[model samples]
Target: MPAVTTKFNEDDTLDMEMFEVNIKAQLDAGVSGIILGGTLGKASTLTGEEKQQLIRETVKMVAGAVPVIINIAEQTTKAAIEAARVAKECGARGLMILPPMRYKANDYETVTYVKAIANSTDLPIMIYNNPVDYGIEVTLDMFEEMLECKNIEAVKESTRDISNITRIKARFGDRLKVFTGVDTLGMESILMGADGWVAGLVCAFPAETCTIYELSKVGKMAEALEIYRWFLPILELDINPQLAQNIKMAEVATGIGTEHVRAPRLPLIGAERERVAKIISDGLAKRPNLPAYKGLSMA
Candidate 1:
C-alpha cells in the first residue's frame, strides 16, 4: 500500500495507540510492503523527528515481515543525502525519493542529486517519477544518466502515461522494477507488464487491491476486470489534490484510519466530506469475495 501516516489526536499529536493498530491491520490483510511518509502519508508536513519516530515504530511493528520504505523529500542535494543517511540509520530497508524539492532542478542537477543520495546508503531506492504532480519528469533520457546508480532499482510511474510501462521494459528491461503509483491504473499497469503497484485506496481496500494484482498476474483478466470496474470510482480518490483527506476518509469509513490531519491540511467539510463517504460506502456495500489464489502471495 502507499501507506497512510500515523493518526493524530485532535491536538495534532501522534496517536500511537491507533497508529499501531492500523499497522497491524494492513499487515494482517496482506499488503506486500508499506510506505512510511509517502505523498498520501503527508510527508510535507511531517517533522524530522516524527519521520524517525515513524520509521523506528514501523520497523518494530513489522519485525522484518515486510519491507518499510521511507520517503525522502528534502529540498537540497545535501539535505537529501542526509535524510537518506537518517532513514538507513533508523533501519529503513529502502527509500522512495523525489527529485529536488521546491526549486526545479534541471537535468544535470537532478541526476547528481539522485546519485548523491544513492551513494549515501546501501538501501535500494525507488525513484518517484510523477511529473504530473511533482513538475520535474524523470524521462528515459534522464534515466540513462541514472544507470550508473545500480542501487536505484525501481520507478514509481505516476506520470499517468501507461505507455511508459512498455517503454521502460523495452529500454531497461529488468534493471528497474516499475510500479503503478496511480491507483486508477493499477490493474492496467500490471497487465501491461509493470512489476507492481504503489497504491493509496489500498489503505481502505487492501484485500481487493492485492486480489486484483494477483488475478491480473495469473491471467485471470476477467476476474481482475470485474474488481477493477467496481473499483474505478474508489480508485478515482487517489488522483486528486485532496488525496490525503480523501484516502483518510475512506480509511475511516472502512474502520482502518481516521480523518485527523496536521496544520495546513484540514478535515473534509460540507459536501466534499459527504461525497467521499458515499463512494466508500457504496464500494464497501457491494464488496466482493475475491477468489482464493493458491499462488505465491502478492504480499
Candidate 2:
C-alpha cells in the first residue's frame, strides 16, 4: 500500500464537506489509501450514527479510488461491534480499532477487546496502539494472541519504540501489516520494513509528505532528509495527544481544512493559534527551496 492518510477535522467537529475535500485532496496528492474516523478525525466525539454517516459519505465520495478504513472505538465491546458492523454495511474497506479508553484492561481483557471487534466483522482489522492515550500497551505476546483472530491483519504502531517494531516485523512479518502512526517517523519506519504510514501531518502538506514517501521508497535518503527537516517543526506539535487540534490549525493556515474543532478540544485561539501560525509560517519560510514553499503563492 502507498501510505494511509487521515481526513483532517476542523476543531473536533465533523464537516462532511470539508472531510470529503480533504480525502479527495490526499488521494489526488498520491496517498495509497484513506483512513476515516481515526484519531485525526476525532472519532470519540462522533455518535454511532454519525460515524456511519461519515463512512457512507466517505465511501461514496471516494468511489473506490482508494481503500477507506473506518475507526470503530467505543467504551464497550458491544458498541464497538455495532460500529464495526455499521462500518462494513456502509461500505468501508476495512476497520481500525483502539482499545477501550475509560478503564485499563489486563492482558486477557485486552485480548477480548480486540477479539470482539475482529469477530464482529470480516473486514480486515488494524489494531491501533497508542499507549500514551490508552494507558495500556498491547505487548508482543498480546499481539501474538490477537493473531488468532481471523480478521486482525494489521497494526497501526504509534509507540515510537523502534525495538518493538523490529521485533514485531521479525516475528510476524508474514501475517501482519505494520503501519507507523507517527508522521515524523514515516521515512524511518518505512525504511525499517513498515508496510505503510498513517500520517496526520499529511493533512497540512500532503504533497510534501508524498514527496518524502516517494523519495524514501526510491532510496533517496539525502533528498528525503532535506524534506523531512522542513517538517520537523510541525511534527513537534504532533508529539502531544492534541495532535488533532494542531493539525487542523495547520490545515486552516495552509488552506487545507477549517480550524473548527468541537467542545473539550478547545479550538486553538489567541496565543495558541498565533504560536501555531508562526511555526507554520516560519517552517515555510525556512524551506524556500521546497515545492510546497513555492506553491504557497498558489495556496
Candidate 3:
C-alpha cells in the first residue's frame, strides 16, 4: 500500500471521455488512488447503474496504476450493500461508506449501519465522517468500536478538530489508517501522523497537492507551506458543500474538465462562475513559476 499517499475525488457526472481524461491526468500527476462516486463526485445524484459504469470505466482506465476507491452511499443499508457489491464486481480496490442520511440514528444504530456495509464486502472499507453533511459524527468510542470489524481499514476524518487526529493516532495508529479529509489541514495532519489525505483540491492542482504531501512526509514543513499557500484560495472554496461545482468550474476555466454538474447541484453561473474564475486567476498570477497555470488565460 506504500502508506496510501494521495487520494482524489472524481466528478460523477463527467462523460466517459472526460472521466478518462481526468483519471489519466490525476494518475499522471502521481496520485496514490482515486475515489470515484464520493462526495466530490456527487454520489447521491448518481443512479445505481451510473455508479457501476463509472466504477467500471475508472477501473479499466486506471489499469492498476493507482488504487480505485468507490463510494457506496444509498438511502438504506441494503441499497448501500448492493452498491458495494457492484463496486467490487467492477474491480474497485476499496470502498468508502457514508451514514444513511434523512434520519438521525443512535450510536447502536450507527454501528449497525457501518456493520451492515462492512458485512456486505471483503474489500477494505473507510468510513466518511463529516457531521455537517451526514448529521452524525461517529464518536471516538464508536470509531474504536468500528476497529473490531476486521475489514474496516481506514477512516476519513473531516472534522477540523486536531485532537481527534491525535486520539485516533494514539489509539488506532497501528491498527487502522487515518486520512485527513480537509485540504487545508493536510500539511498539519500529515505532520501529526495521518497516513494520507483524501483531497478535494487535488482534482485541479494535483502536482501541488502531491508536493505538499511528499514534503510533509519527509519533514519539510517550510517547503510544503510555500506550496500550500498557493493552493489555499481554491482550497477555501471547499468549505461550501458546492466544492465539487466550484472545482469543476476551475477545471473548465483551466482547461481540465467541463463545469457541467447534475441538477440539485447546479453549475456555477453568471457572477458566481466569474468570481471563482477571478480567484483562480489571482492565485495563478501570484505564482508565475508554477506550470499548472502556464499558458492559461487566467483573465
Which candidate has the highest lDDT of all? 1
Candidate 2: 10-residue stretch with minimal lDDT = 290-299
Please list the residue runs of candidate 1 whose C-alpha ends up more than 4 Å from where it truly belongs after superposition. 294-299
Record all residue pairs in model 3 with backbone atoms less than 3 Å apart, i.e. clashing: none
Query: TM per model?
Result: 0.96, 0.90, 0.90
Candidate 3 lDDT over 104-167, as tens digits, reads: 8888888898998898789999898888777889888997788778999998888778678899
Model 1 over residues 1-299: C-alpha lDDT tens digits? 55666678899988777777778877876777889888887788889999999999889999999999999998988888888889989989999999988989998998889988898889999999989888999989889888788899999999999999999999999998999998989998998899989988888777788888878888888988999999999999889888888988888877888889887889889998889889989988898888884464333
Tell me how far the alpha carbon of residue 24 in candidate 2 is from the true structure, in angstroms, after superposition.
Answer: 1.6
User: Taking the candidates one at a time, how many backbone clashes does each contain?
Assistant: 0, 6, 0
Query: Which regions of candidate 3 deviate over 4 angstroms?
Result: 1-14, 288-299
- The count of backbone overlaps in candidate 3 is 0
Q: Could you tell me how far off, in angstroms, the CA of residue 269 lies in candidate 1 after the best superposition?
A: 1.1
Greater-TM-score candidate between 1 and 2:
1
Instruction: Please give the lDDT score for candidate 2.
Output: 0.77
Candidate 2 residue-wise lDDT, 85-167, digit = tens: 88888899898888887888888998988997887778999999889667888888999999999789989898888666788
> What C-alpha lDDT values do all the predictions have?
0.87, 0.77, 0.76
